[model samples]
Target: MKHLSLSAQRFPRRATSAVAAAAVAFAFAGCANYSGISSDKQIAAPDKFEATQSVPGQGGQWPSLDWAKQFGDPQLPQLIDEALADNPSIAQAQARIAKASSYIDTSRSALYPKVNGSYSWTRELYSANALFPPPYGGTWYSENNALVSASWDLDLWGKNRARLNQAVSQEKAAEADMQQARVTLAASLARTYNQLALLYALRDVAQREIANRQDVGRITNGRVAAGLDTNVERRTAEGNVATSQTSLTELDGQIESVRYQLAALLGKGPDRGLQIAKPVIDPKVNVTLPDNIPADLISRRPDIIAARWQVEAATQNIKEAKAEFFPDINLTAAFGFDAFGWSKFLQSSSRQIQFGPAIHLPIFDAGALRAQLKGRYADFEGDVANYNQTLVSALNDVATNISAIRSLDKQMSDANRALTAATSAYQLAVIRYKAGLSPQLQVLNADDNRLANEQTVTNLRLKRTDLQIALIKSLGGGFDATSTNLAIDGSGQQQAANPTTNQTSPSQ
Candidate 1:
């Protein structure tokens, strides 16, 4: 805080004004030119993205904070809760928030006065040839000094305030980033869970296929014993059963692999996945899209919010850089005592006081200051581009998920009809084979078609569930950013406070 000697010297009023005027004139003469470095990027208007504009649905309060509950899976909410609480990513985000908060304190401190106290004592022998008097020459003496010093930057150019604002903006960005992390984590886990459900459904179908194959093998053996079928026919039927069993084995391994993935997503050991129950996803539980999606998306998506805050912080950084072009004034004062002996140190005669204004301005630094200002401008432009890109991508994600869901809905309907036909064909082939109207190969072929169709229907249904989760995530996973005033106009207004503190619902 004390950059210059605090001598107890006073300047005349007219002399101080003249010095200030000269410094001001020199500061402006040496100012950096930042005119050509302005950012041209603008935040992309939400309405300009056609895909988001045509999304249907209105007046629906979808994906509340407890969005996971809509899946009707009792275990899903608990797993997401565990991941949020125990995940390393979440912990890292929390630590960043703490660090950013501390910076706010550090920046805020500059707006106030700083005071320090110190004391020193040294015993030394005075040299005979030095300026010591005859009584003190060639003698040992103790020098004691104590002082209390204070300094405060007047901040007439608002440099410190701009710095403080920058810190605050960065903190808000960190907060939004943490929320984004949560949304990502929960969405990933849910999608993985949906995969687990799909695997279970497939496994069930495999088991049923195995059963059907075994029954066909039994009938073929009976026909061979009665001279109605050859040993080659029986062999074929047995091979079909073995093939189904192999499929079942593969499905089981896939199911376990998914369990492992789910466990990892839950931030737990592999054994934790073993304890996970089969997912019960209810496809009938519809996820309604919120109305005015693109208009409100800026506040809904945490990534967009965070990017916007980054731009806000960069604007403040430019302000701080510009402020550096002006003079910095600090009032410094020191009060202390100095004496050769401790006895005299406390005496009023030994007391000293000094106070003065210290002014600093950038007169010349080659091109370093200019380069730094230019860099700040460049950072602002980069942040603006980043914000614009994030907003565009967020809208694209929403639109992509919406369109995919609609396509999947139609696909699932077709798959269901196909599955029904396959089921009927398989039933008819079995009846015809038993009545001696069709060969055993016909029944096996029909059953294979039926199995494929069943797996297809199951997969499509579960995939639709996964997309529902994606849509919810694309909608910000119920994160309410309404209170986060993401102003990018560089007007230097304080951002609105978000009471959620950058945390999404752990249950989400």
Candidate 2:
């Protein structure tokens, strides 16, 4: 009995000593091989844009809120509003954003633990004298086993984190792209709406021409009946009326074609309620536009920001890809109970456990790893180039639009003056003809000149409006003086993230 008591005490001490030694070993193992990521919070974006030319610009301020309200046409506002809401391209951009966000979530999943469960059952018959023969009686009994295992790749190399960062950057890029698409769509819809308005105004002019020709035809027929006009003269007047009416009919078809395009922009069928009302031409609209936009407004552009974010994502990808050259460390372990009998499975003596770390260093695989690194490096270079290009394009767009707006302003003034002169001439010819002082052909020619001049002026107005839109687009689409207050100071403001360019991320 004493021997048994002593044995029990000795066993407990031995077990305790073993446990203490194992814990120390584990602590030493865990403290090994530590590394840190560099926390340099500065993003090195490409240099900013600088225009090469000193171009002249209209000096007056352009109205903010991108005011189409100057047209005083309620229909213009309604069409723009409805198109923004129902445009399929806008919806597509939204979907891209959502899809990219989800992909980012997927990329981030690597930061967490990974667990797997597996089970198996195997049986085999062995001939006599085989290794251990058949375990029990007969050929073989059922062999059943199950394992619940888990593994986690420690991000000591920052590979997973870098990948996560890349995804985040891409996601931000996608957001910018989506916004850019929205502005582009809005700009397109506005431009088409204005085009339709021009067609309506031009149609009205054609109708006036038709009315004047009809009046001349009636006068010539009356004169012919009174023996004061030759048959050839009356026929000539009727022929002019027919020619004007034909031109009017042709223009009417062209006008409907523009309306159909507007309907499609609104995502409706040809016969849908694209009930576009005519927009009135406002003769009092101020054509003077601002030319000297501030240089620091580039960041507000969705495309520019999107390109910047693309650079960020590419930068993170290069980091992640470069990390692949280093050794990847993985940890795997399991803790469970195993026993020959089910009753003993819970016993401490029946406990089973294992743990280990694995490292994979690139030795050689026919230069595949090096090729990957090179490829990623090339990709980084490409991203840098793309960013520079985007910046340059943005700069050129603003400069060109500013120059155009100024030139159009001058031309529009000249056109209006010409139109006024033509109107005076047309009125004078009408007075002389009524007093029997001028031939009908002279009156007809003067009125034709006036009508043509008016059409030219109306076209110039529409052209100016279009130029306004272009200037607005060049100014980064609705971004204005207020954006100067929200300066991007290059302090990793957006580039430091792991983003997914799912904002349709320049999807190349």
Candidate 3:
């Protein structure tokens, strides 16, 4: 082998040593010391709900996905689909999700190097008295240059990673919020639609009552003409007719009001809502509960899921804040051509390369960094509290709906029995009056009782339907929290974690 001179090898060795020393210095100076916090920290959670008996599902089973179908209304599903597609609230939620997803991209960009390219052309005049002292006394020059530059921030303490984690969590939270909006819109539409249906039924009832009263008024008028009844009875029958007409009028106003509301929910004009036909709901439809309703299903509630993500995002924010207390290491490099003249700039000899590491130490901030960390900690604590509160509220909502449904069921049964007895009594009284065995007043009283009982049954049925809708909403409208993958770690990396199970601490 040919031996190289020591002089030649010495320069290369010295250059290599210089680069190694610079790297060591940069690493030491830019070292960050941070104790990352994990989102796995435990908070208070209930193992069982207070009103467990109200749940009808079997253990480990959740509510059916097609819960709205239980109403037996064919138009309901179509209405819900339209609302989901057109409702302003749902659209807003979806926009937020898109915004959050963009944020995730922004945060992730920080983890990698950024490369930029530029080209410039300039004409300049130099003063003879200036430092440049014009190349030739005072001269104008034209120059063209093209350059490429690259820079990257080294996440020595996972600061960028933490930011990315926060972004991911926020995106997941937004998704949950969107789901929540869908569930809420569906529930509201269903409730309003049910109300409209009930109103229509009530209006029919009023019409029937008006007809009955009118018949009574005619009979009383005939009796008075025949000297069989007094003027007082005729006036009483007319008063009853007036009352029924008033009820019918009021119901008409209510129906229109509800129609307007439903139209708004459908993202349409009031006139468009009036075009919707009267909803057909089976009054006897029963929502079957699973044999065992596990309390854990509350976690599947979209609100609860969103709350949990907020908490995790807050935890990641704390990590990011803590990381800021340490030094930041950014590496920048540029390579391109530069020269006083366009011809020279294009020459290979004009090519230049420059590279170095920039370090930023948190030397003097007047406790600003500490204050930020404190605020982040406070925010995380607040989020945790919110999560707990939301969970509890969700459980309470389910329990309340269950209790209401059970009570309504009993009331419906009793109302049915009363309606049956009143109807029978009214039929008997009418027969007796026709045969001249009972007074006209007795028949009027029986008819009033029957109408009242009928109204009770109708109102109770509406209440039952409302309760079922409430129960579905409380149960998250069949949202499955487990379908989402949200992972919050100090490193800002998403790892699949089961929301139903306690999350393990993420590796730094």
Candidate 4:
């Protein structure tokens, strides 16, 4: 390798400057027009959510990273862990992260120089009819060449840097997506487990009702034999017992169905569901909100975080698109040896060296550059809108769940009172009939009312548990964005972590 220097005497400095000025003028004049196009979408204000007002569990405990454990269900946490570890969705999200990382590497590479080397040899016979010297006419000759080349895009307009930033943002989004998948899977599994718990509770109630109905049937039969009640009463009592039995059977089937759903959520076969023991959940789980209701939600929810990153990526894309309208300047250099014969290739006389600046700009591409810039702006606006929508929906999700949970708390209290009253009335009716003071019809009616109240209370409790899980999910399933590389500002803007200081600064 040899270094070649340029002499001002050979290439006058005055002429060089003239050429550079002309190049710059031409570059500017031919640059594509991209003015007056930009995104106008703004992030939704976090405080707009009205339901974030002070509620029952406001300022209480926020869901921990292991939110499933808070439910006091031993099997649920294990099931959620298995689902997160073994689910195909998790694997798919991991693959996306790997792919996004690769893109980052690819984009980052453009910021550096590239070098290549090549060697070639060929043998050919010259035609006699061609213009050639008599000695070489119609003769076979060998051609050999070896070359090394290097090029570096100066990126004076920051195009490549913008692209790199875009890739980084996409990678961050992928990471957030994976976390979102984990949150979704864990929450879904826990909710399904809660359903299984509710089914078991209902089944218990059904069994008790069946026994109660059978006692009524025996009482009716005794009354009919004594002519204290008509045959119609005895037949109706049999029908009541049959109805309760049918309900118990249906409850069993439903329990099996819910088990199957749990099996699927666990990413396992149906047989695995059969192995699951009954879920024992603490019924006193209460709804709680973190300190920063909607503000912290921006960073907590993975969907919102992912959407924000997408907006960041789109912003970078606009920068990149704008850069394309300017001159693309690069430094190119080559050192090589070329000769007609192999013997001369290694000689100093065969050496060749070249270096220069290469500049290119869009002269006329039929408005392609402008169109690309316009498309980039559109993409940015769309991403911004998407981010805003996601944030709004996330806040509302939390609000809705909290409201329902609070409402369910009130309903549960009323339901318990109704159940207690119905129980007392059913007992009184049974005692009166046994004492021959009331008809069998009255006892049957009271038993039906008691069963209905019992079912309502059981269903409401189940709903409360399900809502608690939903609320946890809505609160981001214990995700902590500050723990990750990305950070969120109070205004809900995304900030990048500074590699040197390991601190977050607002993204430009």
Candidate 5:
């Protein structure tokens, strides 16, 4: 083995001292003065929700993470858990978090010295006439070298610190993105499950209507044979039966289509959806809305939080770009041993060391650095704008869903009353027709009205379920950034119910 010697010299002692003093002074002068923009002032949110205030017993409480469980469906949480484990979007978001975390490591590397070690061996033969005239020049020699080197870029202008900050912010954003994906997937599954239940309910209605229409057709046929009714009445009755059958067929198709959609969401094939049992949902289940929801809590929404993180990352980027306009100071050191023969490699006389400071002053580059700084600032402004838009859109979604849920409550009540009255009217018409006090047309008309009202009532009930799901989603679907890990463990085991906690708001 042989060792390699290292040597470095740039400035004399006095000159080096002066340069160090000057660098210190420049570093103090170049301290970052620009503070980032605040999303709080840029975006406006209402202090309290207006639509939810009218709901009794709401008490302005934040929604629970087990909001879906309020429907008393044992299968919903299981389905959501399966989707979270299997959904490709959720996996992708998790991958992004991993990538961003790696980036944080990359950025943090700039704050510490980089050290490397190496070992090498070389064998060479020299020509007789190159350096010496005789056998000395013709001799073959082997050399071995071992070396270790280190370098560090001093973060005098906070450039490296800014980069690290940017990476950390991006990592946080990625985490929020993961949480957002989970929230979205859970909500989608809940909606799809509810839709499936609605379809089943509608299918029952269609079957009943078909049977009623067929009965009307049979009665009309009997009256026609006795010359009490014309062929026109029989044909009309037959037409109603066909219409009801057609409606049944359409509902079946819709049911299958929704099943396939749900299967895809569960990360399974369409055939798997057919194996799912019909959902048993109570139409009377009413979801309560929170009264006086605080505007600040909107910031807890994952999408909003993700957008805020982006703004923070952009601010750090601007600071990094600004730091590039100042001078850079770097230090390097190397230690090695050089020897011609393997036996002498570890000798003290062969040992060597080298150390120096390098300074980089950007004297000229046209306007590239300034332009870069301007671009960074522009990006920061754009991020701020995006953040504001996201905030407004989030608030709008909450408000709109709240209003819809309230409206549905009233519509559902009206529909229930109308259905009951129609049912009574239908029974009266049937009794009158059997007694020969009313024409068959009157009974058929009443039957059609009852069927129509029944369908309306079912539709209203489904619509209310959909609206409640939407409202829950708008309220962040009970997703809490602090409880993300507990809510989604990715294992088949049941996740812990998300508990309420005070979450740190993003810096404005």
Candidate 6:
């Protein structure tokens, strides 16, 4: 068997040379070729904001990745783990990453060659009806034939590679996007669980009120039976008991609803509740903000980093597009088996192969290719805007959290003081009423005030915890912005764990 003879032919060689020269010139032109999105020049971050990879700040403690573990509550860590493992949004983001990665390979693959194989058989004869037969129409002869051929598109202008490059850029953006999704999911789960914990604490306060009011009812009934209390006094006691009990029922419903929400976030059914313990009542949260760019925040936020990567990817896309204005080169080569007849398919006489190259020339497409390049350039311009927006969003998150932390700290303290005062005032009022010195209204007012203050304290604590999670997420869940085109760490542990998890699943 003879080996396949492959030869490449370049057409319009002069025209191809001119296109190559144009590509180089166009690449330089694309350097500033603003297309769309309100052409803003590419510029570095403003001097005020510090880059993430800066040096350590005053105390020398960089942002901690163990941020979640800092919550002394043992249940928090477990909930976060489950959310990360099961959250459906995270799974969908992971799927996108996989899809983009495969597309990248598909585009890049064009840089190489493709191979194909085939088999066929044919026989012909003419019986007194052939115009070019040996006898010009008598009973003619018959013959069998078999042959094989192959062709390849020669990449004359690097067009195929340009498309491949475009795909590579897109894939890179997708990877960063996937990481951003993980951070958002984790933050969501942490915040939802915090809400549930606060509900549990509030329920405790409601139950206490119910018990105290029920005792008042029992004592008033005794006085009424002994003929020492009027019907009005007994009725008032009954009303107090009813109000407290009503409050307790509503609080219980709230707790159950929150628990169900938590279960859903963990990708589980309502019937199968989560095992997260009630949050330990902590008056204050210790969140340390990084002082300078080098400290951690600049680097840690995922959305900001992902946005920046998008800009870079867009820039590459522009480059790839500009490369398209010129001719493209492609190489297709194949080797396999072809047989006209199965009996002789593999035989020495029957074995055959042939190959050659073909080139593509873009004479004119009415500026279609140029417009495509311009579109990519325009998209890059938009990416720059998105990058700036992300940077601003990150800054806003930090600023908002700082204010929330301080406000909650003050609110929680005030609530505790109010609760203490209300309790003491209510006790004194009860004694005065029994000794016939003060009206019972005073006691009822104080009791309601104390419960309200207590519930307020729980809610404030939960809000502070949630704000902390928000701040952490805004920083991108501890991702490094400077690392790009570098090997992504993790098994794509960021990869979707369950294909169906995103199907109505909510994992972190």
Worst 10 residues of 2 by lDDT: 1-10
- Stretches of candidate 1 off by over 4 Å are 1-37, 483-508
State the displacement of the C-alpha of residue 418, model 5, in Å, after optimal TM-score superposition. Answer: 3.5
Q: Which residue pairs does candidate 4 place in steric collision? A: none
In angstroms, give how far residue 470 of model 5 lies from its true place: 0.6
Q: What's the ranking of the predictions by TM-score, best on top?
A: 1, 4, 3, 5, 2, 6
Over the stretch 43-154, how does candidate 4's per-residue lDDT look in tens digits?
5667765543643335766677787877788888999888998998899999999999999999999999999999999998988788886678789989888999998998
Give per-residue CA lDDT, model 2, range 385-498, as digits (tens). 676677677767767776776787788888889889988997887677555567778877887788888899888878777776665666566643234332233433444332
What lDDT would each prediction earn against the true structure? 0.79, 0.64, 0.75, 0.81, 0.72, 0.60
| Candidate with the larger lDDT of 2 and 4 | 4
Worst 10 residues of 5 by lDDT: 492-501
lDDT string, candidate 3, 351-447, tens digits: 8776665656664566676677667766776777787788778777877887888888888889899999999998898777666678888988899
| Best candidate according to lDDT | 4
Error of 6 at 196 (Å): 1.1
lDDT of 5: 0.72
Candidate 6 matches the true fold with a TM-score of 0.76
Query: Per-residue lDDT for 443 in model 1?
Result: 93
- Higher-lDDT candidate among 3 and 5? 3
Candidate 1 residue-wise lDDT, 1-508, digit = tens: 1122222345666776776666566655654444444444455667766653547655778576789997899899989999998998988899998999999999999999999999999998998888987679889999999999999999876778878978888988988999999999999998998898888888888888888888888888888888888999899988888888898898899889989988888888999999999888887766777787777888889998898788778767766776766667788888899999788999999987877777676655676656887787678778877977898888788888888988989998899999999999999998888777899889988998898899989888888888889989989998887654443432332222111121111101
Please give the TM-score that candidate 2 achieves against the real structure. Answer: 0.79
Could you give candidate 6's per-residue lDDT for residues 197-223 as a string of tens digits? 777777777778778787666666766
Could you give the C-alpha RMSD of every candidate to the true structure, in order shown? 6.0, 9.0, 6.5, 5.0, 7.6, 9.6
Off by over 4 Å in 3: 1-41, 46-51, 54-61, 133-135, 291-295, 484-508
